[model samples]
Target: MNNLRIVVRGGGDLATGVIHRLWRAGFTPLVLECASPAAIRRQVALCEAVYAGSATVEGMTGVLIHSLSEAVAVWQADQVPVLVDETAACVNILQPEIVIDAIIAKKNLGTHIDMAPLTIALGPGFTAGMDVHAVVETKRGHNLGRVILEGSAAPNSGIPGVIAGFGKERVLHAPAAGVLHVVQDIGSVVQKGQLIAEITTADGSVVPVEATLTGIIRGMIRDGFPVTEGFKIADIDPRQEELANCFTISDKARCIAGSVLELVCAYANKA
Candidate 1:
């Protein structure tokens, strides 16, 4: 059990929480991410290591690695490793004890029950006992982190969770397909209607994305990334004074991570 290897799909903020929890519990968790992830909360996302070579969240560091050997080296150093294996080819190579799909892509992007000895998925788009061994609820409600062993989590609501009584109002979406250019960095205080970012279309038409409510720039996509219409690009925290929240894992993320830890422990005990 001390040498258990966990492979996590995605390196976004939510996934990072699970990785952090697993690591603290004495598991070696490696992350798989795309060449360029669209994670808006880059400050807390381990996937940012793919672009920056290394990224730190809270007290943990995630180092970019090119191969399984390098990943093992990172593990020996007591650090998480991020690899460019979006389709999770390493699952077969590493033969990890656990596999977690934390992409939060709102749909099951090919994660199956047989990927590992114990498999778990976060958020919607997965059915317990079918798509994976367990499904952790991600929505902000009564079942936020409830482990579902026989059914699926709630469907995608398309509405962001309410903060300061503002549901969907705290999220910024791209108006059209183009390259995103952010004018404000995360943690910047903003007022309603303030221009935080803009999208440049093919013909050079600029579409401005403004703050829907007065708040702090909690998260925003990296500059120069291509975006499509209606794609989530930023998140504003209505608690204008809570700047530290930007770097720490959210309550929802921590709750879900705890669920994953429980599932892992349960499986290990059963074995």
Candidate 2:
């Protein structure tokens, strides 16, 4: 096994794809996440382990740990370790050769190239060769997952990729800032205008979040999670029959993961 230690910042679905690919390729990867992750696609997100103690995604398991020693132990046991360190406070102690900022927050949140020998960021908020060693395109178009050596990917258009003739209609956003309560779970078929969730504002006013199109719920924020106005709370797959996709990584994610691995390996060889 290649003993390259990699630390992935974020354990969401997209990040999970990278972690899975690294582990299968014989590299040790540890995930860093916040105490409460806001992953809409919980089924394929390893960060869910933070709340469940342990979570399995596509056969690989992620165990939550508090310290570096426990994370190392989990890796020894052949499982991915997820630590609750939003700022990656353990990076100095772990000293991973590679660090990937996969938070997908659409903005740079304190990630820099000096953090590791090879640092990578996904999406447009980071500048390659400056903020990080390189950047992987996350936009869903021609350059999706392409590695950028000295620039950034396209900015987030705030529009979800088109699926089955549905674009923005496939997404559900919170109407008000408050706690979210899901009335329907993922994989459930729903019709347009059907109630999917409710947001209780600080003043106790309830706002209904309805489906914008008829489709299967491919993703949804966890119940009781705090959400901000206009925040994406759910994703509906227009191909209602393809429920299997709800539990597996998307093609976009796999492409990004492969690009990340290739970049990391190329850097390791040069070093």
Candidate 3:
């Protein structure tokens, strides 16, 4: 097994793909996440370990741990460890050889090239060779997953990728600032105009969140999660066959993961 220490900042769905790939390649990658991660695709996100004791995606299990010692034990057990350190204070203590910023925040959140011997970030808002050693494309299209070593990835389009003829129509956003309570389970098929969730505002007024398209619930925020107005809350897939997609890493994620794996291997070879 490879003993190189890899620390991934963020445990969301996209980040989970990178973690899974690294682990499968014989590297024990530690995930750092916020105390409360608002991951819509919770089924495949290792950040679920923060809420539950552990989260299993495909066949890899990520166990939530408290201390550095527990992280080593989890690695020995062949499972990834999720640590709640959004600010990444543990990076200094762990002294990992690789640091990956996978927060997907579309903005650089304090990640720097000097964080480790090798540093990589995903999506836009990062400059390759400036803020990080490399940047992986996250936008959907011909350039998805391309590794940028000298510049930056494509700019955020603010538009969701078209899937089954539905683009922005498939994504659901909170209409008000309040607590969201989901009415439908993920993977459940629903019709347009159907009720999907409700938000209870501070004034005790309930705002209904309905489906904008007919399809399965691809993603949804956790029930009772406080959300701000316009916050992404759920996603609907117009393809009925996408029921299984809700529980697994997406093709786009896999594409990006492959690029990340390739970069890691290249660095490892040089070492």
Clash numbers, per candidate: 0, 0, 0
Give lDDT tens digits, candidate 1, residues 1-271: 2677788999999999899898888888889999989998989999999999999998899999999889778888889989999889989889988999999998999899999989999989999998999999999988899999999999998999888899989888999999999999899999999999999999899999989999999899999999999999999999987999998988888999999999988877887
TM-score of each: 0.98, 0.97, 0.99
Compare the candidates by lDDT and give the number of the best one: 3
What's the TM for model 2?
A: 0.97
C-alpha RMSD values across all candidates: 1.0, 1.1, 0.7
Error of 3 at 197 (Å): 0.3
Any residue pairs clashing in model 1, and if so which?
none
1-271: candidate 3 lDDT, tens digit per residue: 6888899999999999999999999999999999999999999999999999899999999999998789988998999999999899998898998999999999999889989999999999999988999999999999999999999999898899999888999889999999999999689899999999999999999999999999999899999999999999999999997589999999988999999999889989998
Instruction: Give the per-residue lDDT of model 2 (tens digit) for 1-271.
Output: 5678889999999999998888887787999999889999999999999999999988899999988889767878889999999998889988889999999999998889999999999998999989999999999989998999898989889888898888999888898999999998999999999999999999999999999999999999999999999888999998978999999988988999999999888877887
Q: Show where candidate 3 strays beyond 4 Å.
A: none
Per-candidate local distance difference test: 0.92, 0.92, 0.93
Candidate 2 lDDT trough over 10 residues, lowest sum: 68-77
- For TM-score, the strongest prediction is 3
Model 1 lDDT, residue 36, Cα = 88
Q: How well does model 2 score by local distance difference test? A: 0.92
